[model samples]
Target: AYIAAPEKTAQAISTMSPSLITFKLEGDHLNRLNIPVIRRCLEKATAVVVGPGLGLHKETEEALKEVLRIVEEKGIPVLLDADGLKAFANFKRRLRVPLVLTPHAGEYKILTGDTLPGKLKDRIEMVRRAAQELNAVILLKSNVDVISDGVRVKLNFTGNPGMTVGGTGDVLSGIVGAFLAQGADPFNAAVAGAFINGAAGDFVKAEKGYHMLPTDLLEWIPRVIDDPMSHVKVRRSVPRGL
Candidate 1:
């Protein structure tokens, strides 16, 4: 069975636990998707997570728009990340709900329609501005994640470079999606998701060092969440120089 949302879907085998389910979507044609089926799924879901391994394509863009429309009309909170952010770059104003957008620097440029100043402070400011313009929360991913909902800004300093492997962002999207399903607000979901994702990365890095893979990070998530103190000392110290 699959849990369909505005931008992404989490599918699982009935026998498997929810946390073990994988969340990813192919950026194929939206026309191929049955809107009625999707709408039915959304009618039973709490929130939706979009992006995560979704590549950019014209068909995918149109599909995202339709999904966003459905979510807005239904009044469900949505979390946008990865290609979801890219798809809405030119049409952000069309969105009419409280949204949480998670984007890296490159993706941030696309969403804001502005160039970053190549400095951390400037980029954080850009994220704040983007959140204000879109009337949504912005979670700018980096060494120090910055989150803003157009008013207050929060910084997350829990991750290390060892977490840079591919698919980690996808995992993060799923984590936030899970929190949303459990009834957390968008901003709290983003904040807790960032912390948990980073802490999981640190936990894996301690066991496998820099050679750790994204899946390794996922495997450590339970450990981090279950025993935050145990993994707190596992994080690699950030160096001072570039």
Candidate 2:
């Protein structure tokens, strides 16, 4: 069964395939859901990705909180993005479960409530501060992606301006979620996710130029991962008559 707000049902159907059941309601309706029903869904899910295309509604926000609470209590790993970050802002403190928060610069500012410095050094410091405070891995998206768990940080400089298109962030979020489902550590998952996502974008740029769209990036993702290295071969051929 799928769990989402009423308005998101159609989107969920299209995005999450196989015709799964959907639980549609906001935070207020969380209590109305039978405990066993939620448990059953949790049991079936290996990992959960929250906040993709989920809009900001009071009831939806509350429901997200409850979902986070239960997931944490059950020791489930979660990948938080988009509206999920907004819901987290309303909470008092950090969450218990291992989580990865994928935020762009603007979203990062909202989560931390701290003004970002215009310089690169200051931005890295800001990311560290927010990650340490939240006790969760942070993946900050920009021209050069910065990922940190408050201890180690990685800078990815693979992507190009072509990646500035919409849904690129969502693609990154999905990549991280896929890694988390496979049991990768949050830090490594973020690193790999950022690297691959950017590398794919770079590949798209090479093939289609800066006008490349987000869908172009998506198609290149598999090719980039399957063979990250560029190949070079020199061949010499002579005619049989020679």
Best by lDDT: 1
Output the number of the TM-score-best candidate. Answer: 1
What C-alpha lDDT does candidate 2 achieve relative to the native structure?
0.73
Which tens-of-lDDT digit does each residue in 29-56 have in candidate 2? 3333434455666776667787777767
lDDT of 1 by residue, 1-242 (tens): 24433233344332346543332333333432646656766787678887875557777777778878999998888888888889888677736766888888788878886776768788778788778878888888888889888777888887777667777887888888888778887788888889898888776666666777777777777877788776546654532122
How big is the positional error of residue 171 in model 1, measured in Å on the Cα after superposition?
0.9
Q: Could you estimate the TM-score for every candidate? A: 0.84, 0.82
Candidate 1, residue 237: lDDT:
54
Q: Score each candidate by Cα lDDT.
A: 0.74, 0.73
